[model samples]
Target chain A: GESVGLHLPTLSVQEGDNSIINCAYSNSASDYFIWYKQESGKGPQFIIDIRSNMDKRQGQRVTVLLNKTVKHLSLQIAATQPGDSAVYFCAGRPNSGGYQKVTFGTGTKLQVIP
Target chain B: DAGITQSPRYKITETGRQVTLMCHQTWSHSYMFWYRQDLGHGLRLIYYSAAADITDKGEVPDGYVVSRSKTENFPLTLESATRSQTSVYFCASSSLAGGLHEQFFGPGTRLTVL
Candidate 1:
């Protein structure tokens, strides 16, 4: 069973500071990865994604880094804010899937301290 | 209204009762997915549809059934709800345009089976 796992279950960071969340995946056949932000009582929202062909991708104030050699993925958020407090999930999509099935990590709860 | 939406934002039922969660997307993206979110399990895919009348099971498809009569609707039915089935369910839609496969998720439906 290929799985995506997170190193920490919860992360605390101060406002205006950068936040880094890490994820590890077991599926080397995964072709792409996505990061999702899920607030309490809401569904997960797409944050950023990177294809396996690329090592890193940036968007807005966020960056996604993928290390295929180490089977690691990370998300960095700049200037963490109160609104950014939420559970972040990392998902991997295998290239062999037919319907774009994705495997999601348990998630890391990001807590921003004011 | 232009994105995905789930009905009965919250639901409660007793064990052995049958329940259905509705998912509709306006994008007609050609791909829809149903997932259940638990405390430590994250989002586990239950079922997915590639197009109208085309469907397949995902990672955790047990105790659940799905149908795709049309492109916009993909419903998940629990034949006999159990206490373990209590969790938040999310519906997402994605397109293969640009080969990104980035999914857009609906708000979510919270179900509690006692």
Candidate 2:
């Protein structure tokens, strides 16, 4: 069975420091990958995404790197803040049909220390 | 402007009871998804709809049923709730515009089956 997995179950970082979370996926057929941030009581929010065609993509305060060769994916947060403390998830979607059906990884809890 | 919303942000029910989680999106993005979040298992897709009246099962849809009578609404019903079904459920929507399939998620519904 194809699965997406996170290396760490929890991560701790200091405020103003950079945080890096890693993920590994099993299915090579997966073409789309996504990163999500979930608060304690809210649903998962989209952070960043990268297609297999691209190795990296950057957004405001966030960057997503994909290494298809090693089947690895990572999300980096710059200047980690208290508000950035939450659970982060990585997801993958294979190039199946037209619709987007994604499989999510376990998750990594990011905690920012003040 | 309500982008996406879920009814009864929290719910509690007994085993064998039937429960329904409501999801509505104003974006009308043409794709809607339902996912469940558990402790160790990050987010598992339960069902999705491509358009009105079009529905399909996702990774974990055995105990759940879904319907897409309208484009804005996609409801998930648990035929007979079990203790294992207690988790947070999220609804997401995405569009294929610009060849991008990034998803936008709703707040989520927390269900506890006692």
Candidate 3:
């Protein structure tokens, strides 16, 4: 079965430092990848997304890097803050039926320490 | 003001009971999706709709049914709620396109089956 997986289930980051979360996908045809943030008891929020054509995309303080060759994806957060503490998930979407249907990976919990 | 929302932030039900989770989006996107989040599994798509009156099953669709009679609403019903069905449910929506499209999620509904 084609699925997405993460390298770390939990990550502890210090305030003002940087954080990186990694994900590996099994579907080689996945053309789109995204990173999401979910706070306790809340929904997964869209952080950033990177297309297979591009290697990286940047948002406010987050960046998503996609490596189609290796079927890997990563999320990088700059100057981590306590508010940035949440569960991060990487999702992959394939071009199917004129709509890109996405599948999610097991989440990586991010804990920021002040 | 424009975002996704889920009803009944928390639900408590018994096994064999019927439960319906609601997801509403203000963006009026063309695609709406239902997903479940558990402890280790990040999120598994239960169903998705490309438009009103057109829905398709996702990775995990058993024991669940969805309907999209309107563009802004997508509801998921668990015919017979079970202990295994006790998980956080999320609603997401996206525009019609293949790559570079990101899914925005709603606050999840935590369902507990006893």
Candidate 4:
């Protein structure tokens, strides 16, 4: 089945540096996209989300970019801090009549070096 | 005060045994979801509920049963557990107010079936 996937399994960045995580999704019918962060022993925490109607959305020090033509999505974190180190996952929700189904990517581990 | 929680942070069960994982949320979200996270699979939805008494199967729902008897509780039961069922399970909740929105996740439960 076609699903969402990440480009890299792990990424390392120096503190205060910018970090970028990439994701690819196969479902064009998807209308909603979300990014989540998971610490070592916790559930995924919601970071930011973007809708297919827009190409980009920004939150506190975080930005999400969506490219419908390539079926790609990316998350950028500015001034990466040690506390920002975690596993990041991208989820896509396909538009199915009334209710939508969400699919998650494998995830990318972000390591911030202080 | 208002958050989602799961019981039995860790469990070890034998194959063919019956086990149930419990999820609770203080917020009265209209939608609740169950997802399993495996090594390579990331996170896959097992089941979801729009409201009390309304449940639906997801990507990998086989061998898993879910019920939302109450708005704040959603439980997942494995009638006959298998070694392959050993994985981390997470419970999430969201309000379906605006089509689809960000989901709040609970601390996962690690289940090891031997």
Candidate 5:
């Protein structure tokens, strides 16, 4: 019954501004978290990921922050661009005994306004 | 042609009809997964294969079947399709050597059951 969920369904932001997407997960055994970006008519692409051992991880122009205490995760994007408009999903992988599987959240639609 | 690929990008079928979605990956990854993406349900895992002839059920595996006869291919078959089964299906692959958290996804197959 554990799940990963987003705090917002849609977010609108102006160009050149920073954007943040938030997610909450209920699986306490989750050891890895990942963020994915899916453009219209395309498959989800890997963005960034963080391990439970670390609280923050940085990528090209994005950063993933994890709060294990609250079971919250966030993806931060700098200087939002039109190309950045898409749906973003957060996923968690539990360190269970069997094969490793990931649970995905509903996703948040990011709209960049030029 | 080097990455993951899916066949019959779009399909339409009537209820009770049987349909199969084909997926292939050039990376020869050890892990393959099938997931369905719906309006309010992000991506739900349907089935996964850890290796050739090795398969397991995922969160939403009912009404679906999967097989990994070879390392490069993993197909999903719906024995009897229903209107509620209509959704966009994505196939993903991850190498055991490259870490299981990062998966490469194919475009997707859009299935519509009438």
Candidate 6:
């Protein structure tokens, strides 16, 4: 299975605190990584994306860190809110523009506990 | 902002029955994708299209058929629905640009098989 997996099945964080969700991918050839947030009964929405060329990328209140050496990827959300309580998925894109092969990981349910 | 719309926000079907989920996007992004989200298993790509009449299989293309006669329309059909096919289906579209393709996803269509 050319798929990525998360280190934690679920993560619980207090409101106003930062949250970190880790993922490990087996494909060393993968060049792109993306983070997605999915609410209950909703689709996964794009969060932040990182390229193999860079180790980290930041968004509005989110950051994606990629460690190619260990095939590790992590998403950090600042000031976690109840709205952020959803499953976070990490996906990997094989090489360049061919996105049809983007494979997602077994999500990590993020619970922003108030 | 009519970005993407999914029909039959929820569907229930029996085994061996045929079901089609419709997805429409106003962006005309030139790249449309279908994915299924299950417990533990995040968003898995079922099929994708680069443009109308140009479709490609993704990681989980089995038991699924897709057609892209119009760039804004991408429909996923389960030739024979099975209990295993019960999951939330999402449709997403991205720009044709090569780098940093940020995909916008639909709300998702939940399907249950009995």
Please identify which of the two predictions, 1 or 6, would achieve the higher TM-score against the true structure: 1
> In candidate 1, which residue pairs clash?
none
Q: Sort by TM-score, best first: what order? A: 5, 4, 1, 6, 2, 3
Task: Give one digit per residue, the lDDT tens place, for model 1 in B67-98.
Answer: 99989999999999999999999998988462
User: For candidate 4, what is the TM-score?
Assistant: 0.94
TM-score of each: 0.93, 0.92, 0.89, 0.94, 0.95, 0.92
Query: Which regions of candidate 2 deviate over 4 angstroms?
Result: A97-101, B96-101
- List candidate 3 stretches off by more than 4 Å: A95-101, B96-100
Per-residue lDDT of A3-89 in model 1, one digit per residue for the tens?
A: 899999999999999999999999899988989999988888889999899999999999999999999999999999999999998
Residue-level lDDT tens digits of model 4 in B32-85: 999999998869889989999999988799999999889999999999999999
Q: Distance (Å) between predicted and true CA of A59, model 6?
A: 2.2
Q: Score the docking of each candidate (DockQ).
A: 0.63, 0.62, 0.61, 0.65, 0.66, 0.64
Candidate 4 error regions (>4 Å)? A97-100, B96-100
Give the range where candidate 6 chain B is weakest over 10 consecutive residues by summed lDDT. B95-104
Error of 1 at A108 (Å): 0.6
**Candidate 3: DockQ?**
0.61
Lowest summed lDDT across 10 adjacent residues in model 1 chain A is found at A95-104
* Local lDDT at B62 for model 4: 97
C-alpha RMSD over true interface residues, model 2: 2.3
- Backbone clashes for every candidate come to 0, 0, 0, 0, 0, 0
Which tens-of-lDDT digit does each residue in B76-102 have in candidate 5? 999999999999999999898655456
Ten contiguous residues with the weakest lDDT in model 1 chain B: B95-104
RMSD vs true structure, all candidates: 1.7, 1.9, 2.3, 1.6, 1.5, 1.8
Native contact fraction (fnat) of model 1: 0.64
TM-score of chain A of each: 0.96, 0.95, 0.93, 0.95, 0.95, 0.94
lDDT of 3 by residue, A65-88 (tens): 888888998999999999999989
Per-residue error for B46 in candidate 3, Å, reads: 1.0
> Candidate 5 docking: what grade?
medium
